[model samples]
Target: MTTFHAAEQGLAGLELMAKIREFERRMPLLSEEGLIRGSTHPSLGMEAVAVGVSLALRDDDAIASNHRGHAHTLAKGADFGRTMAEILGRADGYCHGKGGSMHIGVKELGVLGTNGIVGAGIGIATGAALASKMKGEDTVAVSYFGDGASNQGVLAEAFNLAAIWNLPVIFVLENNHYAQSAAIEDMVAQIDLSRRGEAYGVPSFSGDGMDLAEVYELASAAVARARAGEGPTFLVLDTYRYLGHMAGDTEIYRSADEVEAAKANDPIEKLLGQLIAEGAITADEWESMSARIVADVEAAEQFARRSPFPDPAEAFTDVYAKETQG
Candidate 1:
């Protein structure tokens, strides 16, 4: 067992950190290269929520995500090659050139998918959990959405449905303080988003989005509670997105200094610093990990570039059963 203590060397814990770092860095570069056609809302400063919530899921567990989902997809174990390829408009991608950057799916890896619609994944996760309960399966469901999506009435309705039926699901709200150009304080009636879950009689808690260990601890408890037939739990991960709503967001919304200041508390930097301080990882280890991640990401990018675009005819084919397609 990997103890959260310094004694365990915290190796597996580092992998989660490394994963987040790679995802955060590679996503923007892919977009800049004009490979990822759809808009990308990078979780630049909010790695902890994805890392924490993912630890709560198993191979059979399903996760549904919203627009800003690179962290969620990576944490859910989507193949970096295919994930990037999907973003790069390649046929070998998760959607096989169908669902681009904002819509990636790998069912075998437990990522049901990333939806473009706000608060849409909530219903999907709820329905999946209900199915698991009825089928007597141990599988649980997780839905990762932004604080911005909380304004959607569908989320409240999902909370009600999950609570009344005792479905095995976890709702992770990554509160990054903005909904496009609107600030969290400007839009929400109560900045305490957890209160919305409480209103539906669901037990809700907040977690530190920059601390993976803290996230893991909270998520573990939430997962166990839901699977034990205790019902759903709402988690508000306090974090921020360093990137704008998309790649070329205007500075009129916020100050450049604010972005730089937020990067100071970046989860990857904080994790690496702690690992070195605790002697769990040496300088060389950090260097080696960085090199490996860079090489891997570069290779995936090359693969995506070489991959062919999906055949236009194929889209009409997956639309129906074999008989219908034939």
Candidate 2:
């Protein structure tokens, strides 16, 4: 376990983790009230991977996210109000109410966008890395995908391309045990996902996604390797999502006891315990920080509610590039 000092990075990470948790917890409620229209995949138990990876990235480094990407966007320093507004389909969203839930993108923050397609972001991140290499820039691109996406053919192609070209990219596989409703054991012949990169000559690693410190350490090392022009690295983070695959899933695949067992390793609680044990933060301090975060999330929800939807004409706009006279 990495010793977490009472410093900016460690404490700030804890806060961000807490914020991600609070933000996702609100999604189901919003959906239930019909404030959110479509399916919202809440990453209820996977906050550590998002925050840890974001901590290792530079401001200019890019990330392409999978469907369950609210945590990834938030950890990448997106505006809380705007993220909520985007899900709410308000004009104030990152995509001006068009992208909604699965497609929010913030160019300034280097968040390419969240994809609804299972393995689409893998190719997108690879292309971004190729662009960076061509431009002679040191910026690395990260592709965040789930265990379900691991079966997609694009991952293999991206891995091969990135490895052969030596493009700086990190393939983060959030292996939450099940791919939607099917168990991972049933999907792949090889259970250990970390070794998936071996054939492509890309270095691979695996770690406890429920432990923020472990995740941070792993991500920091991977990011360092990429920044040093060492080419792509694959990370298999073993995590679990407390919620169903989407908002309305009955979750018949897993039982209540199974979920309760997984919750025993809750990431937020583990991190808080570590911080408190190290005397880096007091219990009261955490309480105050958590309360502030909850209040802020509440404020974001209100902002989303008050914001107006996009004009009907907006459907025709942003579809194609405007022609510029030569």
Clashes of 1: 0
Tens digits of per-residue lDDT for model 2 on 76-177?
A: 999999999999999999988888999989999999999999999999999999999999999999999999999999999999999999989999999999
After superposition of all CA atoms, the RMSD between model 2 and the true structure is 1.7
Whole-model lDDT per candidate: 0.81, 0.91
lDDT of 1 by residue, 1-326 (tens): 22255334245556655766666667767777777786877777787778767766788899999888877888887777788788777898988877787888887887878989989999999999999999998888999888789999999899999999999999998888888888999996789999999999889998788787778878888888877888899999888887778776774799999989988887777777887898888989888977887788778777888899998778775454355553
- Per-prediction TM-score: 0.93, 0.97
- The alpha-carbon deviation from the true structure for residue 208 of candidate 1, after best TM-score superposition, in angstroms, is 1.0
Predicted structure with the largest lDDT when compared to the true one? 2
